[model samples]
Target: MSVLRSGSPHRPARSLATVAGILLALVSLLLGLPGTAGAAATQRAPEPRHPEQDWAGSQIARHEGTADGGAPPAAPLASVEGVDVSSHNGNVAWSTLWNSGVRFAYVKATESTSYTNPYFAQQYNGSYNAGMIRGAYHFATPDTSSGAAQAAYFVSHGGGWSKDGKTLPGALDMEYNPYGATCYGLSAAGLVNWMKDWFATYKARTGRDAVLYTSTGWWKQCTGNSAAFGAVNPLWIPRYGSSAGELPAGWGFHTIWQYTSSGPTVGDHNRFNGAMDRLRALANG
Candidate 1:
């Protein structure tokens, strides 16, 4: 007769149920039960990051998607057309590019002190032999070695410049670091100093300033848009857009604009700021 317990509230029972649910969740998580959060998290391996795949504009294209389709903008009547290739391009058909009216080219030659482009000779020499004013570029990996050391390595490889009217100055492909931190884990001031070392060493070795290939966005994030190298380094800005778009802090004008990665022919398409004479003048320097 005293068994009637309906007068009591269910708060305690509800609390016990809540505790039981929590325990069950914990058990599933610990066991990585099928269709649970832990299973989803542990299912796949992360993609491994590797070098050599880090070529010119590779990071930029990853961060900022390129326009691979649609009608390309008409080349400026007074502008010179160009292309840039890397080992990723694998022995570019320079003859075909020349027939397509491409007048200049840049080919990646080195990355840090550890790696060199396997197809560099084919791309670098083939472009010149095809009668295009060509140059070599080094993909900067500032995290691995000192800028001066990397510079030495670059010149010892094919990243050397000449005064020949047919050769353009080597370029420092200093875009976002493909392997790690944006500025190679450096402070803004540190980045500037590192660039200084690279430029000095490269100038001493080649007697010509290396061209800087970078995007304005990366410059802002990595170096706080420092204007230190603008005056001394020729800017080769990559902008896949309707126009060349706004440049970084220091450069008032761009020497070359890589407007589209997916051009009609091969490699990334660029435009020299002036006509053929101006292109030759820059090369002669």
Candidate 2:
């Protein structure tokens, strides 16, 4: 028989009881139970975020229209949602994007005359395989090379067109100059001529006019409000500040509008300027 150190036969039972009390206290503290030591410690609140800031790229930005806010433009200009991607987005799971309600995608194919997106094949074809209307775009560098040369390079790489009724026409991305000289050191008329030369060559090669992607401000500053491209080429305008902003001269309406860069997918968020039928018609060409 084991003798208790204290002259009490119940000493072991008392000691066990003490230990059990201590264990319960530890568990309470660990779990931050009410009236426990851990409950006294303060926890800082999470940092605040802006309406437009979606750091994870999992949430669409505020400007993206939802049913709760309002429907997209109406009638002749009602919209269907879409997106555009570049090398910056890296490799994307195209189905995930399509499931997220993206009906179309414009993948970055070429920049200037030499640079081609290494992932062009996967993005361009993957989008199609995943059931999204697909197209390619070229970032213009008119300062370093003529528009026709870049267009040629663009098409040869991945900007080519087919009458498959699922391929949207290629786009000319002539936005703010990412390189030196914002206007490419060209006068307004010179810019117009360069665009015409590129468009003309692209038409001759592909038999379809390339979409023109630009902003009202950029068009005014660089092209001197030239409406020369308004009649033929579809306009893909970017105006993130509002539902719709001033359009470039010549085009009475925009074909596509890039509303936000922080879309749930891996690209800038955009919308078709029409409903399903219109989008299908565009793809047919």
C-alpha TM-scores of all predictions: 0.80, 0.73
Candidate 2 RMSD to the real structure: 16.5
In candidate 1, the residue pairs with backbone N, CA or C atoms under 3 Å apart (3 or more residues apart, or in different chains) clash, namely none
> Per-residue lDDT for 32-117 in model 2, tens only?
76533444444543333222221111122222232222232332346788888776677879889888878898988887776777
CA lDDT of every candidate: 0.85, 0.76
lDDT of 2: 0.76
Cα RMSD to the true fold for all candidates: 12.2, 16.5
| Candidate 1 lDDT over residue span 85-127, tens digit each | 9877887989999999899999988887877888989999999
Clashing pairs in 2: none
Off by more than 4 A, model 2: 1-77
